[model samples]
Target: MDEFAFVDRSKTNAEKYVLRQKLFGTEEVMPLWVADMDIATPECVLEAITKRLAHPIVGYEIMSDSAYEAQIEWFATHHDFVMKREWLSYSPSVVASIGCAIRAFSDAEDEVIVMDPVYPPFYSQVRENNRTLVIHTLNQDEEGIYRFDLDRLSTQTSEKTKVLLLCSPHNPVGRVWSYEELSALCRWCEERGIVIISDEIHCDLVYAPHKHISTARIIPENTVMLLGPGKTFNMAGFSISTVCIPSQLLRDKFEIERKRVHWGDGAVLSHIGFEAAYREGRGWYYKLIAHLSQNAEYIDKTLSSTPIQYAKPEATYLAWLDCRALGMDDRELRKFFVKEARLGLSPGLSFGKEGSGFMRLNFAVTSQTLTEALEKLRGALQGDAYV
Candidate 1:
């Protein structure tokens, strides 16, 4: 419990807190906008970075094979997925990999399909790359479960569409795609000759009964998986992630573009932290899931009768809140949370038009912090909250 307890980041220059005034126009609100955890990074990762400072030299260094091997073992043990070293390569972050893959596999004006209400970068990468953006809208069922419409997406596809950016155990709205859903999507993409760029950064943050299926595991040759330890270990500051391309032909194409862009191996300290995290952070990770799960439940129970509607995510620390019930527009909804609730959350409309009238709360903070945020919401709602 001590490990997961609140360690104040107010003085750490954490972006979530530092940018609160700029983003929300207030420094008094609880800054929960960013995806990184409020909990400390895994001790093993920190210790490894500290130990690496023993070396006087901090020159350019290639990542070690043991780091890749550690990740392979972790995935095999946890996700039942086996990966070959030959298929793996280094990337600074998943978003960079997406842009690289876009340039490698598609030409200007070629189409890329991105889901609505996804991580905003998925949309930006496509547009900024000069590719035609095809938005695939995801719908929520009566029970509040978000689902993709394959038939509709299939109809939306064009011959010029060369890539599909997938988010497994999706962000904002956390749905861990079932094996069957992944298989079907993979088969469809493969049939239409669309290469899938899957961002699985949140794979390890999933909750109980909802398993994160790596898109590469379903059809590796047709998939490019963006995997990293950043989200799992709360080590995004390290800025380390990798690209897993299983096909030689795809890797050749990617390598050519990668060289053109000069995307070299990452920092020395980051490499050490990456390997250590996958190698020794298992016990800490499961405990994090338990902690996050309890936080999710707390949000669920607290907001059940409030004006805002929430369905506990099957995976991810994100709480996708439906604020349409408050009868406020997107801008008003944002202001309400900032001025009334004294909390800062991500405005759903920033994700996509489909995300209108929603708010995404990061529930990865300590229970005390979460309780305070919820109480603030309840107090703001006042007479509106149902007993």
Candidate 2:
């Protein structure tokens, strides 16, 4: 696997690499913002795409049954969740799938509940669809472990509340919800008739001692799981995701809205890549997880001496840094990282007001890149300017 070495993405159209200037107001900062990794995509995925391009002509494409079956088999083999072929549907992306579900399941002015300090799109998709965005802010302990505020959620949900957008093996704060936690949530939502759009995109990336429980496993009847190989195999550019709606009625409604929007399956190469990723990318996937775990440990050890504090992630490559001890407001904190540390990171405030004193760092880069970024950060924090 050649250690899946760092691939320079600056020359490519990768958002994390190329859009640094536009996003952070400077291209000089080391980018550790966007979720995608700096490592190369799995060889199997690349091989599949390459083989497809050998054909003479490109034409319109339809998703093949084999692709769907491959995904079904992968999930069953990996997560112990069995999926029927009929329950699956095509989505261009997880965010796109959420938008469609919001439109299909809820009406304008309907309320959609989300855990605050979540993925930014969870906020945007609800508001953009003209739905009332209800927030249940997650509570964090002194130890930095985050837990869902079920008591607050109980009060916040009402008759108008229609959907709950869940990020399992959550992003940023990275607490993979436990089975007990999921069971309670499922019971709560089931009583209120709230449908869950479980974004398990990061499920495959969970670390040791923390297990990822698919909400569908607990309550498949009311769950629509948004999954894809994009995050697991680093194929986001392909723009392919899957929506698993086990309920026949919900599936019918989602399909109607999906077709109405004219959002169809991706190109020919995307299908090939998707299947190849699920079927042949297992070995590479395990290696990537090991690499990511090492990076997380490195960050933990590096940041311990500084004012910044990080709770080792339970899942996902993103590390949420607690910058509150630095006493800088969001803007100043962002500037400090950009100008002082020369690092471009996703400002915590972008996730939600609850995220104000933190920043999300993508540690999916090569070990060499991660080490350098950490050293730069360490020097910046120790410098007299920051002191």
Off by over 4 Å in 2: 384-387
How many clashes does each candidate structure show, in the order listed? 0, 0
What is candidate 2's CA lDDT for residue 159? 94
Over the full model, what C-alpha lDDT does candidate 2 score relative to the true structure? 0.90
The true-versus-predicted C-alpha distance at residue 377 of model 2, in Å, is 0.5
Worst 10 residues of 2 by lDDT: 378-387
What are the RMSD figures for all models against the true structure? 2.0, 1.7
Model 1 Cα displacement at 116 (Å)? 0.5
The 0-to-1 C-alpha lDDT of every candidate, in the order given, reads 0.91, 0.90
> What is the Å distance of residue 229 in model 1 from its true position?
0.4
Candidate 1 yields a Cα-based lDDT of 0.91
Residue-level error in angstroms, candidate 2, position 47: 1.0
- 1-387: candidate 1 lDDT, tens digit per residue: 433878889998899999998999979899878899999998999899889899889999999999999999999999899999999999998899999999999999999999998999999999999999999999988887888889899889889999999988799998899988889999999999999999999998888788888888899889999999989899889889999999999999999989988879989999999999999999999899889999998898999888788888888889999999999999888988888888899999988999999999998899989988999899888833312
Error of 2 at 116 (Å): 0.7
